[model samples]
Structure formats: structure tokens, C-alpha cells
Target chain A: MTELALAIENLSFAYGAKKALDDVSFDVRPGECTILLGPNGAGKSTLFSLITHLYDSRQGRIALCGFDIKKQSLKALARLGVVFQQTTLDPDLSVTQNLRYHAALHGIGRKAADNRIQEELERLNMFERRGEKVRQLNGGHRRRVEIARALLHRPSLLLLDEPTVGLDVPSRQAIVEHVHALVKEQNLAVLWATHLIDEIAADDSLVVLHRGQIKAKGKLDYVLQTTGANDAGEVFNKLTEGHKG
Target chain B: MRLLHYWRAMMGIVGRELLRFLHQRERFISALVRPLVWLFVFAAGFRAALGVAISPPYETYILYEVYITPGLIGMILLFNGMQSSLSMVYDREMGSMRMLMVCPLPRWFLLGSKLIAGTAVGVLQSYAFLGIAWAYDIQAPLMGYVWILPALVLVGMMLGALGLLLSSLIRQLENFAGVMNFVIFPLFFMSTALYPLWKIKESSEILHTLAHYNPFSQAVELIRFALYEQFNLDALIFTALSFFVFMSAAIFGYNPSKGMMVRKGGGAP
Candidate 1:
């Protein structure tokens, strides 16, 4: 079995007396593409925030590669890379410059950072547009650039919070495809948060989060087979609906 | 590599901010013009009305334009400080601000980088304003030019850190403009930026003493005296204390633990 990439236990979060994430617990294994699927306002975003150190959790613990999140956040964050829901890029900066700054923040080498940037941009087929300002790039291209930027540090655990929020179908599929390959190729652990079910593959692992609780979490096929449905989408709807009920 | 990484990150922030400033050419133009207007129009009308007198730094008759140059420099720093805070609020609204806090570097270093970047922008703007003062034939002490550089850098850092502190503590951009008018303008007006303490003393001893104790006044006088190749110990001490206060606030604002300054009014995230 691959080592546990992330372990969150008995975690609870409150937003001014309103419990956003209550009694939440889950584990994502290495080389796994575990999708945290739920509808809007179902605590998916809140959970992502807690994982990324956006806000401290009220109770329980968060561990990244066995390192306590609070005790060793730098070490935890060093191994972790996140792409936020909205575009976090500075629109005024060139694409290359944006990546360069991100690389700098992670303390990457000048020569190495330049080379990796070129390599990742080429991987996404965005090399020609490197020097263009971020405003000049289309939405799809910018999403691709963001994905490439997330991978720049070679993070072991990657988190994307509604990464395809504003993208078209093709762009969304491309991001999913790219992420799937990276997870397998690098044996990286990934927590992909989204409200869309089409993005989750049949064999991929799935965790259905509804109103701050994990109703069901297992292999996608196992979760679907238990529903006795033809496609994972139909089963996903049933699971989420039952979760709310 | 780490140091180089910091330099690159810092320069990149500066580059991005400069590019954004370029896009808003009207803003740069207007901000630059306000002080020039004060220098040429207001000072010209007030110069003769105020009459020339023997001031400590003044070797002979001095123009109002020359008297207000250092104060105007202080104004540039003041406004630039608020503008940086404005950008921080703007970025927070746009969600890009969190990207900055999430960097893998020590959070303080990342904040320090932003402070330096903003300070560089403020210093450059201050220097441009000073160039116009030079065109008015205002005589600054020759050695004062050298001293002014470090002085501006210090003032810029102090003001920038205050802005950082505000950005961290502020809940929304809506309240920032009010803070600018209430806090920043008062700090500028009540200071020695516009008129000397002796001039202010004629009106009220309370006002003169307040001006003397004002942190911003110290900043102004420090720059003012530096312009005349003089350094007051009181000004230096006050400036250092102000720096320590704002720098500590910024540190508290950015602390990953045991800090309430940054978390006071923000959303859960």
C-alpha cells in the first residue's frame, strides 16, 4: 500500500458559531486522485481552506506526510502545493514573470527555476506565450499556466480548490487529464475538490462530502457498485442526495 | 539560491506593481501633479504674503517653494503609503492576496519583500517630486542629498509597514478610504510637513508641542534637516521609535501564531 499522503482526523471548523465542517475525517493515499465531490455550500471549500492553513481548525488535527500541520506548517506546506479557486495571478505581470515569482517564493535556484519553468510551460504547450502578459492569455491558457505553476516545486501532495471554476468543458477536461497524469507519473497524492462529477473517473477514489461531513469515501467503482448504477454520475447524484437526507 | 530567490521575488513584485501603475497613468500623473501644484501655484501666491525671514536653515531670503519642499516629500511618502494599502485591499478583494501569504518562504521575509517593493515605488515617486523642487532653484545642503537617500528609505519603510499593518487589520476596502482621510491626512496636516514648529508655535504652544511629538513630524523634520545637512537627535530617536512600532505591528499582523492583528475582522479563510 502506498503511504498515506494526508490524514485529517475528527476535524471541526466554525464560522462565527455556524459549524461549517463538523466531525470530518478522511485519508488520501499516495498516487491517488481522490475527488472530494459535493454540491455548492457543502463544505468542500471550507475543508480545502482548513487543509491549506487558511484558517485554523477548532478541534482535531491535520497531518501532511505525517507532519502535524500546526507544528510544522512550513514543512507541511513545503511538500504541499495549492491552486486556489479564483485566479491568484497578477494580471499585470508576464506569464514567465508570474512563474518566476512563485518559484522565488519557494526558494528555487535561478538556473533551475528558469529551466523548470520552460519545461513545465512546454509540457502544457504554452512555451510560446511565456513572455506574454497574463492579461493577454485566454482563460484556458491561464488555467493551464496556473496548473503548471502549481507543479513547479514538484510538490508531493497537490490540492486544487474548484480549479476549473471558470473554464469551458475542453479546458476542464484538459486540466483533469493533466492532473491525472501528474498524480500517476510522480506518485503524488492529490485532493481534487469540485462540484462536478464528470471530472471524476470511474476507477478514481471518491469522497462524498455533504454539509461538512463525509458520508461515503472509497474507490469510485466500489461507491458506484454499491449503488448498482450504470454510470458513476447517476450514482454520484444518488449518493449526494442520500447524504443530505 | 535562497537569497537570489528573495531578490527575484522582491523585484518581481516591484515589476508587477510598476506595470500596474503604468496602466493607471492618469493616477500616477495626478498624484505627481498635486504636489507640483502646491509647489508652483499655492507657494507662489503665499511666498510674498508670508514674507521672508531668517530661519535657521535659511542663509538669506527663502521662497515658500523652498520651505515646503521637504514637507511635500513627506506628503508623497504619506500618500504612497496609503496607496500601497489600497492595492493590498484591492488584491484581497480579488483573491490574489492569499497567494502572497501562501508562499513557502518564511512569512516575515515574504512580507518584508513586499514592504521593500512598496517602499521602492514610494521612494521613486518622492524623488520625482523632489526633482521639480530642484527646478524651482531650492538649495538643499550638498551633503544633504546623500543623507536624504537613507532618510527617505527609512520613512518609506516606516510608512509602508504601517500600510501593511492596516492591510492586515482592515476587513474591507470600503473602510480604507475613510481611514486614509481620517488617519493619514491628520497625521500629515498636524505634522511639520507644511510649516515649521516656530511658525506653528505663534498660533499655539500646544500645537507646536504636538507637532514636535508627532512621529510624522519627526519624519518631516528629519528629512527637512537632512535637506539642510543637519540631523537632529530627537528626530532620529522619534523616527526609530516609529519604525519599531510599525514594524512590530506588521510582524504581529503576519504572525502564524499568537497574533490577533491579522485575524481581527477577516472571514474564516
Candidate 2:
């Protein structure tokens, strides 16, 4: 059996008295992509923050490859890579510099970092543009650079928070395909958060979150069967429509 | 192995900071220009207004340019510290701070590395400023230049800590102007940057005491004495204490739970 790369148990978070993520729990096994589908302000960002330990979660536990985030944050974070919703690249720095800086932060040796950087950039077909400043790259290419940077440390689990937010249809489709290919080719566990519906493939696992609660979670077919819906659109509406407050 | 990672992390941060500094040509020019204006214009205006007495370092009367040269170096470092913190605020807004914070190292180490980077930049600016001043004939003992390096680092770290603490306290980019007006100005004016404490004492006892206690005053004094190849023990102790206090406050202010950063979460715009 494939081991779970990420595990969230009884995770709940709040902003003052307002509940953001309530009693949410889930797991993503290696070699699979779990889509976290939610509307804006549906606590998806909060969940990512808790997993990344950017925001402390008072109520539950997060584990990466069986390492508890709270007690073993260093080990947990060491094994995890993230691409936040916003682009984090420095526009003035070259692509190679950005990747090298990230690799150094992860403690990869310089020679090892160079090899990994070359490998990831080559795999993404961005090796030729490695010397170009990030500002010179188009949006899709920047996203590709971010993905390559995320994989430079060879993380077991990669969390992409709406990685295709502003891309064109082809760019979005290409990124989604690339991630799915990574999962299949390398057994990389991915927890991709997105509000876009068209990006979800039939074989991907689905977790529907609304009003700070998990309404449904499982394989797409299983979620559809349990929600009594024809497709993901109806299932999403069934889980979220009236709850908008 | 972990130690190696920490070392690399620091090098990465410092390298990025230097690269950014190099890319921004206007910043380097402005950093140098600010102090030069003070040296040539402000000092020239105050030349006849103040009288210099024989002191340990100055065996005879000195020019206002010579008197304020060390203070000018302090100013370069001071502005650079605040400027680095301004970048920190920008980095936070741009999502790069989150990138730095999630590096799997302890938070304090991350912060400490950033402070080291900022200090290194400040020291580099100081050397550049000093070179220009030396060429302009605002002379110091030949050995004074070498001896002042450590003093520059300490003063840079202190001011950088103050700036870091301020960045953690201020939430928005718009609020940073308030920091410049409130924190930076007061620290610069109330200190011995432009005038000695005795000069302030002659004007008002309260102002003298404020200048004496101001950490910036201690920082300036630390650098001022070192520029003459002398050491001020009181200034050393005071600046060191302030560094600890400010850095501790910064570390606490940057704590994710109680910090200004976490309230917005990672989806910060």
C-alpha cells in the first residue's frame, strides 16, 4: 500500500470568534492528486496555512510523511513543497538564482542543487531560460519556474494553491497535465487547491469544502454517488449554494 | 548536516540581498547622496556656528566636515537599515516573506540571517561612503578605517534590529511612512549623530538625557569613537543591550501566533 504523504486530523481554525475551518480532516496518499474545491473564503487558504505552519492551528494536527507538523515542524516542512496562490518570485532575480536560493534554504549542497536545478528546469523545458530574469518570463513561464523551484528539493508532497489562477486555457491545461504526469511518473502526492471546476479530472480525488466544513470527500465517482449529483457542478452547488452567508 | 543547511540558508539570503542592492542603482546613488548632502551642505552651514575644542582624538581644531564624517557614516547605515526593513514590508506584501518563513529552519535563525544580511549591506554602504569621504579629504587615521569595521557591523545590527522590530509592528505598506516620520526621525535627531551629547546638554538637560539614553545615540557614539580608534565602553554596553532588546522584540513580533502577519493568513494581497 502507498503511504500517506499528508494527513490532517481534526484540524479546525478560527479568526477571533468567527470559524474558518471547522473540524476538517483528510489525507492524501503518495502517487495521487487530491483536489481541494471550495469557493472564495471557504477556508481553503486557512487549511493551507495550517498545513504549511504559516498560521498556527489551535485545534488539530498535521503530519507530513508521518512527521507531526507541530512537534516536528522542521522535518515536516523539509518534506513538503508549496506554490502559494500569489507569485513569490523576485522579479529582479534570474530563474536560476531563485531556484538556487530555494535549494540553499532546503540545505541541498551546491553541486547537488545545481544538478537538481538543471534536472527540474530541463524537465519543465525551462533550462534555456534559466538565466533570464523572472520579469522577462510570461505568466505561464513564471508558473513553470515556480513549479520547477518547488520540485528542486525533491519534495514528496507538493501543494499548489490555485497554481493556474490567471493562466490562459492552454496554459492551465498544460500545468494540470504536467502535475498529473508528475503524480503518475514519480508518485508525488499533490494537494491542489482551486475554485476552478474544469481543472478537475475524473480520476482525481475530490474534497468539497464549504462554510468551513467538509461536505464531501473521496474519489470523484464516489463523491458524485454519495451527493446524488450528475456532475461536480451540481455537487458543488449542492454543498455550497445556500450556505453562502 | 543541519549546520551546513543553516549556513547555506544564510548565504542564500545575504546573496539575494546583495544582488537586489546591486540591481537597484538608484538606491545606491540615493544612499550615498543623502550623506554627501549632509557633509557638504549641512556641515558647511554649521561650520562657523560651532566651535571645536581640543580632544583626545582631535589635538587641534577640526573642520565641521571632519567632525561629522563618522556621523555621516552612521547615517548611511541608519538609512540602509530602515531601507532593508522597507523591503521586508514589500516582501511580505509580495509573498516572498512567506517563502522565507517556510524554509524548515527555526524562525529565529531565519530572522537572524536576515539581520545579518541587512547588516552586511549597511557595512558595505559604509565602506563606500567612507571611500568617497576619504577622497574628498575628510581624513581619519589609516588604521582607523580597518578598526571601524566591527563597529560598523554592531551599529548596523542595532539599527537593523530596530527596523525589523518596526516592520513586524506595522501591518501595512502605507503605515511605513509613519515609521520613517516617527521612529527614524526621532532616533536620528535625538541622538549624537550631528552633535555631541555635551552640546545638547548645554541647550537642555532633558534633551541631553534623551540623547544619552537613545540607543541611536549609543550606536553613533560607538561608531564615532571607533572611527578615532578609541572604544567607548558605555556606548558598547548600551548598544549591545539595545540590540538584544530590539532583536528579542523583533523575534516575538514575528512569531506567527501573536504577529501581525498571520491575521491575514497566506492569501495576503
The DockQ values of the predictions, listed in order, are 0.47, 0.66
Model 1 residue A49 CA deviation (Å) reads 2.4
* Residue-level lDDT tens digits of model 1 in A42-132: 8887787677776666688989888787777777877788888888888878898888878877778668889999999999999999999
Which pairs clash in model 2?
Answer: none
Once fitted onto the true fold, the runs of candidate 1 whose alpha carbons sit more than 4 angstroms away are A225-245, B1-8, B11-27, B51-61, B256-269
TM-score of only chain B in every candidate structure: 0.90, 0.96
Model 1 alpha-carbon miss at residue A179, Å: 1.1
Q: For candidate 1, write residues B45-70 as lDDT tens digits.
A: 89877754667656777777887888
What docking class should model 1 receive? acceptable
Return the TM-score for candidate 2, rounded to 2 decimals.
0.97
Model 1 residue B159 CA deviation in Å: 0.7
Which is the leading candidate under DockQ?
A: 2
